[model samples]
Target: MNTNEEHEPRIEVTAPLGERYDEMLSAGALGFLADLHDRFASRRHDLLAERMRRRVEIANGRDPQFMPETAWIRQDLTWRVAGAAPGLEDRRVEITGPTDRKMSINALNSGARVWLADQEDATSPTWANVVEGQLSLHDAICGILSFTSAEGKEYRVTAERTPTIVMRPRGWHLAEKHLHFVDRQGRSLPASGSLVDFGLYFWHNAQRLVDAGRGPYFYLPKIESHEEARLWNDVFVFAQQRIGMPRGTVRATVLIETLPAAFQMEEILYQLREHCAGLNAGRWDYLFSIIKTYRSRGSEYVLPDRTQLTMTTPFMRAYTELLVATCHRRGAYAIGGMSAFIPNRRDPEVTERAFAKVTDDKRREAGDGFDGTWVAHPDLIPIAQAEFDAVLGERPNQLERTRDDMHVTASDLLAFKGAGGEVTLAGVRDDIAVTLRYVESWLRGVGAAAIDNLMEDAATAEIARSQLWQWIENETVTAEGERIDVELVHRLRDEVLGQLPRTASDRFDDAVKVLEQVALRPEYPAFLTVMAYTRYLGETPTTESTTQPETPAQPKSAREHARLVGERDELPIAV
Candidate 1:
């Protein structure tokens, strides 16, 4: 054990460093991460434990309600978040994508007001990805980032006015397996992915962003409680103080995606009052959260197919309406959800239809008084911007709209029947195909994939597997009158696998294993990513080790998808 009583503990690089990793993993950066882990890792663990407790309570028929203790935070209408920071104002349209070199440049050149450079759902946290993403952001801020394709095409930031960059780190529930932190007592544990992503970005770019007339901005994800919000606020305060930036220089927009988070929007905002810039309607993950939270309650809590759960669904409508109302009343930006319609170049008709659907979605959001919305492709930027432009001809935002007419209750938010659609054979097949494709792509280092002309991420895969589990547990009857059982799911899974093309690099075999472990297993895993990461992507332990990785209770999934095929029919159904 490398005990250090006189100084801060060390952060050991467990995996072999890749090209230019030295630049990202300098002694100073490691020291900063060590300090962060030493201070807050225990608290993060406790909060995650609290999340599981909440899940168990909900599973046993305890419905979540707005807390009476936090009532003062909601009723005290005098408090408001800090006004929008310099580059965050007038966010009529924002583009979201992974932080690769080409995508980063394209997003910067795209005619949107902000770029959500995502490191969470859209990124697979391979060591190369982790370091290279930080490098891309650093180089972009310094105005020198560029990429040259193998075919000799050069990509650079060509826009005269680029979008304001806001990075989304991994959620608190994840651990960075490649790096281990040694605490003062000579104990080693995996570093928190949240801190590694945030600490690296903030440590490198805080001053550079300030020099360019912007501060470090972020999109906080998977925050379930106001207490989690307070934790992030404290992180921001500590980060800024350490870097000598003024207080509140770091602004964050919390994603109200989880079910528990919906009831505490007001309290969440109050906790991050000094650093809050807005709240986002993370539609896909919100749906997944609903199923994950209440999967065991009963059939009423079971959701319909993912295709049927649209933003216009009654419960979804209530969620978004309440989000806008809460944000505007508190002087924060109400950003709408992403329209995951990617244009198909080979089929102009497909592209045209995609444009039409995106237009209607953005139009509804604009008319509902959202300050802005998100787009996955650059071609949709003009469509989204045009809608917001029609709504606000000369204003930067609709902050004054104040959607006071909205009134939502707990029952309204939990109106699952409102998402009405049958669990048809088509829906089940779609879920299986999508999970296989998305997980395969993830294993091969692509986090965001174009499936059926839509941009799909980890959230999409989570929804697919979660719905499958929920349907099986409830013995859901399909529209075709076939009951969902282990045998039927196995046949569909094999059929989907047979249809997908097999390339030398495709991980379809592993993807199948992942689906079964997460969806077909008797016990529910809280997160499929954890199971996948630990089984396949965790560090290989190539270096000297003082301690083993701490294993948190994780959701089960396949690695190459071949592990549990023969035994599928033997797994018992849980009701």
Candidate 2:
């Protein structure tokens, strides 16, 4: 524990302390978290408020476009991000998975170039998961991470080549209710999940990573605007300084998942240029954001089946094109989205089709000048790598081909009419079934699950539920001429639930309640996980209250953050 911890905000652990939890929730680590919250909590509040304000503007019929105020940053092409840090330069095949022990070993032993240690959408933040996930990373870095099944089978990282690890923390909007922080004025607040995840990972491993010839690298998720990006940059600066590391020792790749972010890609990159490595195409979450943002507008924003809106769709194509162009122009890496096709070992035909689809997706990305792409299963790594190798033989990346020839506009991005497909009864049923199964699994403390031979996480659930709500709001009619309404959704929900197994331990009933609340309600919840977290997982408090609340408590301002500048200040950072 740090000797100076008494002066920091006091951290209270609300959950039952399990085995080895103390190692992660040490006094020094909690002190680091408290300092982070003290410095950035107010700005986080301001940014979230800005997000709500922007959403209201969009709902008032103002379409998102390139901002007029930040044109100078976009017009200036001379600035480049502090390009790829050590162990991150030659990333051609990246595998993304939750940070479970077995999955972590499999991912590291896989021949992928990088492993995205996902703690965000790919992880359900049960108390055990939140603590043990940190333990997994700590052990993995120490080269002792392993797992043993009940049947005596063991899994370990023994491959000749291991992938570099890049951690993805939870987004800014989520709160970690298992932990709380008391400010100097004695106001208790829910801990910011982003701060706790990033602070623990960085505090425990920053020096160790530097010793291993790598730095603390990260993938930032769910950023909606450049101002949020600026907040991240500020946090990175403060964190490195707090750890006594160099100003630019940390590297981050922002996930351009939201629709507003796509319009400000250049500005997002420019804000984090000192620590930015690249931008990733979070395809599923991008679709979810589109539905959530424009769900109230009209039929034009109402999409077809989720299967119909593939990466080749016009709007998706525009998003990716602009991403690659902006990244290459600014000397940053352009990574592709995940292909969530999990292979079936028992069926040869199923595996063959999975390989073909993944190959086609990777082939398109490689042909379009992407630096790398993501795969869910290790079995598909070689397939993705082969496609990228065919395009980039002996070359680390195709950074030289800037692709300045391709130009995309806001109209191209909002071209929902180009995705012409009729919504079908089968599509609605599939969404219902998938959402139910995934939500049940999530409530059971599993974030990543194989459903219908595809690896799915919270992003998939978000898309599914948002589509249901949007279809109901727009009174969408299926190809069979059946109007999608509350009755239809409720009936289909029952039908899907009837088909699912009802074991004694199943949480299907709770899942149904969640589905009804998020999908069948008049007001769309910003995130389904927030509702589930508060209602199910966030019942415990330091004062011994076990009763669940219907909604999450709003964050309160603690104090003002003082801007810190070092010897390497080129621009003033907004705090």
Candidate 3:
């Protein structure tokens, strides 16, 4: 808790951030200035301890390992919306699934990347596949890292080679992923808590690559909190010690999706900011929380439609801003979120339009700006990379922008506007600092957060704190005094007023119709964009959530795998 004697945030400072400052400096000298600006962080006399603590955390968050700058939204990694259909039409969908040959090839093709193989969510398959009753996560991940499509030209793209398999965060618990039902015998489940295989998993994986003289990396999944992040750090430390793969070499990219974790973004980032290679905006899980956390009280929060709500919403903008800020602040590459679907079959318009929309979003994000965006479909991958390349468009990678905002001064910090756009510069920059840290933590793919933070009940307090303030301060909004149902009102304003813009290039009424069916229904509540996220997962990823999730299915046999690849469907790539 941070407070003054009267419980207000202290506003005075003891010393400046630098050793000495009697001279003037230019904006070009700001990078060196941030280094010097940091010394003053310890002089928080007027600030609350909590705020100052966070400030210090931000100050000390200068590390080569942190990945606040890059963007990688995990849910978009797959094209399927929980195995329903391709959200859009596209060429070559890459189906990233487990050993289960039961997965639909047709569905897998929904996106370009068929990221077959599982480590985090597919633990059931990992454990079940243990021959002699012993399965290793390393082996399991290795087993399905890459896939050969229906066309025989086996795409060599994969996170193979344990050293190449980076795990920024290694401590992962299954229950954190909401695989609710545990063993009937009621034994401690793997998901419920960090399991033993975790350390061994990384150690074995890292060792595999070290012996082969390569770097190891991973895509950490389902992270819910910071302790989980620290736990992962611990695992990496252990793996580094045991595997002899250079003590600080264990690397990973994490996913940010669940509810509580999203709010605690800064704290999570502070905990593991240095270890991230990239950050992801776990779109689907985040949307699931938006409604699931809210409407479970017998009511629902209906967002506008996907096309209308996703790319253009205030929250999404804020999220993208944070991602961009994190990347810039940390000197890491900023990535963008996914566009949800990929074209399953070739229809130039479907893919062309989808790619165009994705390109637009990515371009906008890059403009605002981001480093890269994701595509679940292989075709989309090239498109995403192309968009990024185009935006970066021949600009030589200027080492000039590297970490210039470090030693932030009173003046520099004072210039930021915060989410309200009304904050003093310092506050805005501080907020950017915090948000960036969290985004970096999210990008350490393959790691998992804890179970507690992945809440079923939503916390509206943050909405009250962040959104309400943001709404009130916005220069564009014109509403009467604090409306009774603030959340309801703001939501309605967007719903009623923010009808899709034509430039959105999506069917407004149809998108609304698609969302409303799930929203207005008495079946279940609708929050952020869970339906959209689930739609994305089912469409690209092999698995779909059902009333009852059953066993891990078998994989394609050698002959079947060969056959699936031998016959190339000379179909068009997109609509």
List residue ranges in candidate 3 displaced over 4 A.
1-201, 211-213, 296-301, 393-575
Local distance difference test scores for all models: 0.86, 0.86, 0.34
Question: What does candidate 1's lDDT look like per residue over 147-246, in tens digits?
Answer: 9999999998999999999999999888887888877777777788999999999988999999999989999999999999999999999888887889
Q: Which stretches of candidate 1 lie over 4 Å from their true place?
A: 1-7, 538-575
Writing each residue's lDDT as its tens digit, candidate 2 over 427-494 gives: 89988988889988998889999998998899999999989988988899999999999899888888
Q: Enumerate residue pairs that collide in model 1.
A: 509-560, 510-560, 510-561, 513-558, 513-561, 514-558, 525-555
| TM-score for each of the candidates | 0.93, 0.93, 0.45
| Weakest ten-residue segment in model 3 by summed lDDT | 80-89
Worst 10 residues of 1 by lDDT: 566-575
lDDT of 3 at 6: 27
lDDT of 3 by residue, 145-169 (tens): 2335577545332332111222222
